[model samples]
Target: MKKSMLAIGAISILFFSFIATQPKIYAQAGGSSVPFLLISPDARMSGMGETGTAIADDINAIYWNPAGLGFLDYFPKQNPFDENEELRPFRQVALSYSPWLPQFNADLFYSYGTIGQYFDYLQGTVAFNFIFMNLGEFNRTSANGDPMGKFISNEFALGLSYGTIIAPDLSIGAQLRYIQSNLTPTVAGQQDAGNGNSVSFDLGLLWKPQNLPYITDRLSAGFNLKNIGPKITYIRESDPLPTTLNLGLAFNIVKDEYNDLKVAGNFSKLLVKRDSLGSDPLPKSLVTGWDNPGADWSFGLEYWYDQVFALRAGYFTEPSTIGGRQYWNFGAGVKYSIFHVDFSFINTVEANHPLANTMRFSMLIDWR
Candidate 1:
């Protein structure tokens, strides 16, 4: 009776925790002035130049797709830490476990995901994740260009994910998350520009079909719906939420225990208020793509060796009608036991954009 009661109590708490996470809404009028936390992170070692479903394994998976954590198979075996293990901390603050420690383990992985299509169970695994992002520090400025104050922007997320062999030749998974964003409010130029707090949730699914007797495990498909939350806005100015629907497909030309190669394509739709996306209203004369209202499609690629090191790259476009701009991405990562670390560099192909040379880092550790 005691055991059963404990199990029921745990379930009740988890259920209520999931409900407590409310969705965020955007302001209606000051549309374009959204917080920078909305920008997605680079999940690929070779910065995928576009936005797509992320396939990440390290602690960073907490940010991209928590479902990837189901792949951890390193439990209940040999010592997770031995004499030769080294402490690895990279540019992004990701923690790499030292093999010298006793019973130490870490898990870090990136998923090769896309926007659409159904994948089967013959391959792939389940996973979990935790993530934190810092938006750097800045001083609040008044209209006269005087320093009014200082503030910071940041985000935190926790996720639970599961993947299963749903069919003889199919594997699938999903993730549920609780996300929070905090951007300090400030008065900028002629108005009070800074925004405050927002809460949201995310859902993701991945599927990989079995390889045919004659065909190799070279192809798979995936999809995800992210940042689907309530509207968030400041005072009189109200904007829609920064919701996005994503779809993608990938091909693995090379796969083995030691090395692998994967290429993928994705499409995304930004579900915010129309006026918030741009200054002018659209006319019937405009014929635009629904997957990416103001942007073009994205392409990404990944390569790995011995599951110890990885490299990635990608490209993204912002259609010509809205003033086209291109992005280039690059990233690299390393894994040791259950600890993993990653770093990525993002920059616009266009030289002069203020957001051009951005950098991101990630870390993950798993111990049971």
Candidate 2:
């Protein structure tokens, strides 16, 4: 009947959303829910091969490697009598938007926003962020197959993060997230099987050595364990979260008063496992998931001129067996005073790929 059709349609929307946002490869893709959690939020990192764990020194670090916040300084005391008084941006804000799966033009879009404040007492930055994925509108139906009305479908996550330095050269960060999926509401006789909710957390670490022999302050490394939590159940079936382990390294190629260049690389592995029986539990899956044959890797480069303009390029690749998503990303950014704007484009190696030609725009404001 119409109710059954509505459920099917709602499921299709959820499926499509998941497929469109999967920027990397996963061995058992079906074992996870809310794949949007894995999406790269800002255009800056997107342009740089979706790599940021190592160069997470900005506000976007809330989503990349929150530990990077430890390296940032907020508003410092400034006075006419003190010549060494320091004054830097104390509040940070970021926003990003992208039309998801442009190849289909299905009215799908993704948006992100975050704000951070540095507390002098804590000596760290605490941030809160929101992510939303609009899956377009769906036609509501009656038992007779007649259109009754329209309903909007969407998924979102809200998270809080805090990062602080634990040592002179090392930092740690953590995030807590709440996720929700509103695929469809109970209509007619369909019992809202498309709705789901869950919670998760992320842990991250960053290291920037200043006393190393050759590397000194020119190298950075990061590790993040993301989306660790229980499974999400829509109505009956429960699925695991898109838990993942990411590692990255960044190196400064050139640094001077007028020019800056850096290169970064990342390795990511999905830590969710499922088989004919069903999905495995948390700690168990973390180990069993590695038994599967696959991982994803990418590299990126960024060059800045006079601290005002930047050009970026990156390459991303994965095992062919896990839905290989290889592509090149190019982007540009400009900064003026307290504002920064960035734009990026994706060029998939395989022509007509769902992600090809996709573009994202983002902006940031630093306030002192």
Candidate 3:
């Protein structure tokens, strides 16, 4: 146990060292294509400042950290069956929808749906997810500024994920995804607006200790590498995917029969890098980008009453040198029988911010 802790500490030190030594560069934000993929689509997670890499334990884990799925308890030993002996549900589904940048436009929206199922025989869980984004319609015009009608832009991704317990206290998972983006149709005497398609993958790891000297058993640590894939091109110029690395920690502050409180902290850094000559190689850029000033950090707290109702609040910040986004998040949730509903609101600190006053709603169902 001491050795494991020491190893973790060493790795942490090395990672921060890279961050500290990385050179600062001033660049435009939203440089990557399909930027919508980086948005957190899960309402429960978004309510908590989008910091669920370590706290994910429900079907929503399919998006935040698939490794958490391996730890789900579909069947409790104490009451495996009720009086009717109807087998409990091993499958769960969730749907979420949100108005993206509603402060600027109401036509833009995002939607996501996911399903997960546990297989006792395989000692693992499998999940499928879909995400869609509508960027709204834009007026099309000829090179001479003549109106040529209107066209809508859209994006979508489909993914398959699998998770399994690799050790007594460690779990791992992976997800493969196909992404498509359509920005425009075509214009007369101009290059035809084409659709862009690319493939990406996500990898995650989770560690939970059963017992510790002073720490509660609810403490967990997680790491996730997301959106690792080739570049997407809609025209002459190609852009890299929004690759990110996330690390997080979660712990229970209070635990009781009727009351529960949990806290979580997460840090995220973009792995894509750029130089005077443009984008760099993937393997080298991932390390060099560690020092980029775009890192994001968030902290969140949640309280629950009798496992039926929940209240959450959190704060998240990004360096001004990057996008200068800072916001406070508030959320609430209710669970009755096998149905759950969650809602979240975001309030930006800066006045007239494009992301201010955004909202997300989600519904979940668990079935046998």
Highest-scoring model, TM-score: 2
For every candidate structure, what is the RMSD over all alpha carbons to the true structure, in angstroms?
14.6, 3.2, 10.4
Question: Candidate 3 lDDT, tens digit per residue, 1-368?
Answer: 11222232342232222212112322532245677787888778888998999977888887888898888746443354556555443688999999876764437788999998888787888999999987666666655766666666678999999888999889998899999988667656767565688999999999998887788497999999988888888766677787789999999999999999999999988877765567755766678667566688999989999989999998988876775678999999999987989999998898876678889999999765
lDDT by residue (1-368, candidate 1, tens digit) is 11222232342232212111101211221132232323454444336654345454333333344333333223333444675554322112233211110111111111221111112342333333444544434455555766665655444555545544445534345555555444455444335433433445555555545664655555555556555444455544543444555666777778888988877777755444443354222221112213233534688787789978988888876554433546777877777876556666666776654335555555544342
- Ten residues in a row with the worst lDDT in model 3? 14-23
Ranking by lDDT: 2, 3, 1
Provide the lowest-lDDT 10-residue window in model 2.
18-27
Assess candidate 1 and give its lDDT: 0.46
Best by lDDT: 2
Distance from true position, residue 291, model 1, in Å? 8.8
The per-residue C-alpha lDDT of model 3 at residue 335 equals 92
Better-scoring candidate (lDDT), 1 or 2? 2
Report the lDDT tens digits of candidate 2 across residue range 109-220. 8999999988878888899999998877777766687777777778999999999999999999999999998877776666656799999999999999987887679999
Whole-model lDDT, model 3: 0.78
Q: Give lDDT per model, in order.
A: 0.46, 0.84, 0.78
